[model samples]
Target: MATLLGAGPGIVAAGARRTMTRCDGLASVSSSSHGIERVYLSAEHARVNRTVAGWMREIGMTTRVDAAGNLVGRLERATPSGAPDLDAPALVVGSHLDTVPDAGRYDGVVGVLMGLEAVRMLREPGPDGTGWRSPLPFALEVIAFADEEGTRFGRALLGSSAVAGAWDPGWWSLADDGGTTLHEAFVAFGLDPARVGEAARRPEELVGYLEAHIEQGPELDERGESLAVVSSIASARRFQIVVEGEARHAGGTPYDRRRDALLGASEAALAVERVCRAEHHVIGTVGRLETFPGAVNVVPGEARLSLDLRGELDDARDRVWRSIEREVDTIMGRRGLRWRSAEVHRAPAVFCAPLLQDVVREGIVSTLDRGVDDPATIFSRAGHDAMAIGAVTDVGMLFLRNPDGISHHPDEEVSAGDVARGTRALAEAVLQLAADRG
Candidate 1:
């Protein structure tokens, strides 16, 4: 758990601040009207990749755009004699560069910039300025996954799924708001859709995948901690629920004669929250809701709502969803409304590998001196590319605190000091894995 790079906390903090500045600069290159919205295969996506590629090249890493349009950079391992060894299995570290519409700066960008900074720190000369502090036992690969937010195609993890060998050809037909199919967008971006499988990495070619990302929730901030080891990403299910009832004039409708769809939907949303709150580590949100004949003078004839349910365990999430469904049924029946739901998405929870979790803990311990008893372990409610990559290789995550626990919004923020600690922790993690392999 020794400090691998020999830099004191102050020096590492300064380095991380500079890297964060670069990430902030990249955040301005967005496609949205006001906030960041670099979707998959868009022009903004290309610009960010080019800028990140430049940064990667400065660290003496070879860079390429993978078939799936993911920006990839590799630093080969060095032999005892200081020669590069190309045959080594690589340890991959990265996060997505894509952001949700109107996203904050650090949600995904911090991890990529931090990975690059860690690699730069690794290649820096020793204190005496003569040689590297330690030779690498495996290659280091940094990936800026092309798409994680699913803002354009409504399908998350497209980039990581391709890398994990889970890409489905059916996704090519998926379209965006502008009517551009994913396949056409890939072509326009100079990527060959038919060759997307070329992006896949064999399990044997990788040691593992590590990601550093903002906690995107209140846990670490509430505890006054800046870092945590992620235990798992939550299992999630999404559904579109519709309630139908007879429309009536609001002024003419009496309590006994009214069948209000919006009222039933409102009750169902509350029921979802109640059911989710009754369980540990469960969350349910009705993020989008709409009513037919949107007017104050008329009782709603129909209501549509979106339900997103997540939990630390798959079965637990499913159970909560069932309870919510029953509640919705009862509310609709009482209101004389017909209700139906169509599932739109489902993702199983992915647990971190125990060995990699230990490495993450050691990294965190090596970076901080306070209360080394045990670092906080948290379950992530937000979806990440790690979930997709977990299909092929063991995946691990480091969560840095987000001030006010905000994400996917312009108000989301992370401190420079915390990012610096995260950077050092990530670098130390790579070193720890190298030592274990050696």
Candidate 2:
């Protein structure tokens, strides 16, 4: 495939060298992944946050922290002190900053890095004769959202929900493993919780929102494609199940007399698989487990499990839940154990704006020219900041295929060639959206 062409003269000229540089950048980002593994809670949390903010400031962009602790760096068409208020609707490119425990750096950092680098690249003097210039037509804002993993706080899209005005301030009282409330964290970050309401805006104010993220799936590698143009964000339904059973000494308890909660929970876990496997896009996983009165020689008295159910369609996703319900009923009837299931989360599938997806596709076709054999459009199982932002704007996403189909781990990777390809596509797409063709 020919190198991805850029909008400006001499942009493609540095493609080869830039490819190596991007590889180094990926290595640098991946290094943070290693650091995450070495530390508790992954110091990458603060490091990734600082790295992105540092990059933004290094380029002379003005920075601000919103009420929800969202980090925003702005590159205005005209400087704040020099030009009229950024009149035209603004373009926003962003992704989350928080990570799952021991997560790969590229999962969240790639989008932040790509957006920052694009702004940096565009800010450079244009070609040989064009002189000092910025390629962006509209004011561009790069945001590194505080939390999207729901990892530490048990709530996905915390920062984005605040920005979208969907979150209630009362939710800030929710605590984490450290017993720190989001409100407390906000204060520590020097942001005012009272101002969180100010983050929302009328939908028309944003031109478009774009995010480049890791695929987190094997579709690209399975199909031999380098990128995946996202069509829709998957729906997620999470639940917590608690099982009650009689506890007895492991040595004294007869197998038939044991009404073990862990035993019942195990059956439910297997049922989750049976249900999800019956459908095309459904995914059911039991990611967390806790035992009550934990002991090595005792029959488990109680067990709590967290179930994550996901799918591309609301109906299909719901079906998996129904299957789980039936399985739980059967297990209780047979085991004679009491159980209770509570809904933890339910986010419906969000479709990308067709026009925005088309624009991204055009960017890929124009820049990479990988041909039909390596077609790039596909569905994404992962959720993103764009899902919340999409509620208020025309939103789109670009996926850089993870080499090993690994994510949320220390070994995540996306090749430098892939980054270059993805960037060219994103840059071109941003240019198209920023242009006022109407």
Candidate 3:
């Protein structure tokens, strides 16, 4: 683990230090005055977009708000104005701006800022070393997606999915906790729902997509690695499960007469953990559970729970889901309860393109002083904008270590040193992709 070797690593690390400061500044624009709580189409979202767009303009990029509320900043080649009429395809770098309630400052925010910083470094003195910046072979665009958390609409990847041309008409009916449908919110936000398709990017409009993100798990932390190349985003399935049983008086109901829905649901959750732990590369979580008639003494009549299941492979994930389904059925049958489940979401696994994968790996390796030629590649159980963006272009990612692998919470962290190495690697990858394309 020698210090990063190439092209003013020290200076780049300083730039990363500034990106960290900018992350701190963005955290202040959250819904909660005390913590981060930005979401799609919120006043906070709009404010953050405006602020980030200003940062983009500082480095000579032209910024625009796309139809889906995504903040897009483009550095079009051969065009000093960064206007939209460039003939060159673009190399896209991006991550989401939205966050879950009480989110960590670095989950997706770090990537977006890192993209900006990486491009900033590349825009320095050109190949001839005679100018402040030289145009890249392909246009460069950094996007700050409005909603990858799906916290507002209960459907993830809205921004990137729209950019990928996968927008669903059914999403219009999706409502927020405040009773605002997505359509209504879009209109209120000054975006027309009818024009969301305008945000869709054609496949030929891009060279490829690259992102640098923090590892949301502890593998990198435990391995003591600064970065890992991403192998693929996981396949996922989510469900809303309900278990029904008759309500009975707490004191009068004997053990034999008792049919407690909470107990049944709890047992089902345990069964899910058991089944998933027994299998490799598969995991399941009961993230939410609620019992009807929540009373201290009343017997529960029904229980509702949320299941989030993911696996490295699609068939393996589906197989685990089927196993969980059967196990829950058995648990409820023995408990004298009726149960049912409805799938709320499903996203297939997305593998990285091999050439882009190699580029990221090489970029990471180059950052190391000379210790390792091959860095580890990780399978991402967490979904990303990359999962959606992969639909329209070759997409790849570099994962910076999150100390203790905690994310989606305030405790998530990545060191300035890791940030420096990460941005350098990300920029190098983009350069590699450009050269390869040429």
Candidate 1 global CA lDDT score: 0.90
Score candidate 2 by TM-score against the native. Answer: 0.88
Error of 1 at 242 (Å): 1.2
**Every model: Cα RMSD to truth:** 1.8, 3.8, 2.7
1-438 per-residue lDDT for model 1 (tens digits): 465556565567767888878978998898877778899999999999999999999989999999999999999988778788888888999999998988899988999999988887787753545324566788999999999999899999999999999999999899999899999999999988889999999999999999999999989999999899999999999999999998899999898999889989999989998898899999999999999998989999999999999999999999898888788888887888999999999999999999899889888998677667488999999999999999989999999999889889999989998998899889888888888887
RMSD of 3: 2.7
RMSD of 2: 3.8
TM-score of each: 0.96, 0.88, 0.95
Scored by lDDT, model 3 comes in at 0.89
> What is the overall TM-score of model 3 with all chains considered together?
0.95
Give Cα-based local distance difference scores for all models. Answer: 0.90, 0.74, 0.89
- Which window of ten consecutive residues has the lowest lDDT sum in model 3? 125-134
| Runs with alpha carbons beyond 4 Å of true place in candidate 3 | 1-6, 79-85, 126-134
